[model samples]
Target: MPSGYLDLAELEQRADYVKTFEGVHIPGLLQTEDQIRAIFAASVPKLSEGELEVRVRFRLRRQEILGGVPYEAVIHEAALRIRAADSKVARGQVLQILERSEHPQVTVRVVPFAVDGFAGIGDPLTYAGGPVPQLDTVLMDTPHGGAFLDAEAQLARYREVFSKVEEAALEVIESRQFIERVVRSA
Candidate 1:
């Protein structure tokens, strides 16, 4: 994994539960191959073909953690509508998310544009719960790279943020229907 992803991957591996709040992009755990490739292809410095493939592989591998632990995602509607790749890739991404949402341990919720109260925090964040509460960690992306927050106060703040985001999201069934509507439009 790259430096930006090392700590996140390690935390995912050690976590027994995970919750993510994404306001702009699809959670990495739910993104498809094309989506991941498109994201890397649009990087600031521009990754070479080999570098892109390596990073894609690392992310795909990290997704394997989803099957081993409970996972919940509160995704903003913008992520579902964005064409990070082409229309085909965007449609496929939504389809994959819908399929994954069927998993017993996987929960997907969406916060639609119609939601009046939630404007979203700043960036997307992943809250990984370790075996013990004190071991919990929060990961958020920064312009520099991924930032890890494990301090008690930081964890507490992120927990509240996650709770608010989750509260604003639609129920699981509604989210699946919302995604289906997006796919139909695609």
Candidate 2:
């Protein structure tokens, strides 16, 4: 439980009721080990080799929830195509997306770049389901750190944003095709 974000831990504990909205990068629960490693290496260049390995392992372990629970993600196309690592790494990442899209418990949708006035233009956010709908929280990513939103007003705003983003995104099947097309071109 190394994740600094409380919402992440809550999501892991109650993954069956989670719905995620990812506008920047692939959601953590869907990332492969290599992709996680590459991302950490780039983001924290000073991390020692051992530390990098530990972090990558932790990330992969966190992703294990995908095997047992239900979740949904709406990823922006810009996040998918951005080469955070080398070409081969990018290809592997795309392939991971293709594989995960097949899972019955997961819904992977892509918001194409052509969608005008997308709601996710600012940053990526995640909404975690609670025992009661009113208790759910919205997690927002920031350059300095992550922020959790549980206030009714903030949750309402983020929910609206996520709804609009999902509307602009392709359906799961079409998203898989779009991802495959991008992977081939990559």
Candidate 3:
């Protein structure tokens, strides 16, 4: 959800729980300003400096939900290891993830390289709950752009996909430890 999307505001306000997955990039809500700037700078067509600032601000603003909502972020080890900017930025990100994991509302897990049967490589998703289970929406990332899936079958399949990936992830405590080791090597 970006700054001016009324729909994003409304949905987030009414949601009971939010779940996210990141395989390549950091999940949008958990990304920091420096990381966001680095990503925008690396974009193919390249966003104007003004647009980049706007996006970074929007992303940081959306992060406030980490304290308000029950959010679960399942990230992969590969995403954790890649230094989008540099070691300082990566270390800050890992520390941020560790700090936020202490919040009662946020749950962060990492799927390490040793994990098996985890084939959700191309899927990046945020499953936002609604007033009722039937109203939930699955937001997915594709090569082209973002996609929203709301049909029953689609929802069921995505739910299963998320479940399996989450199953392969390290426990919260272990995940933090795994990230700490990464920082040590960095």
- Best-matching candidate per TM-score: 1
**All models: lDDT?**
0.90, 0.78, 0.82
Candidates 2 and 3, the one with greater TM-score: 3
Q: What's the alpha carbon RMSD for model 2?
A: 1.9
Residues 62-96 of candidate 3 have per-residue lDDT tens digits of 78877788999999888888889999998888777
Per-candidate RMSD, Å: 1.0, 1.9, 2.0
- lDDT per residue (tens digit) for residues 22-45 in model 1: 888999999999999999999989
For model 3, the stretches where C-alpha displacement exceeds 4 angstroms are: 1-10
Highest lDDT: which candidate? 1
Question: Mind giving the per-residue lDDT tens digits that candidate 2 earns over 1-186?
Answer: 245644476666674456676666778877877778878887644788887888787777777777676778888888788877778878888898889878888889998988887742558777876678778877788887788788889978888887887788899889999999989988
- Candidate 2: deviation at residue 149, Å? 1.2
Q: What C-alpha lDDT does candidate 2 achieve relative to the native structure? A: 0.78
Candidate 2 clash pair list: none
Model 1, stretches more than 4 Å misplaced? Answer: none
Q: What is the lDDT of residue 177 in candidate 1?
A: 95
TM-score of 3: 0.92
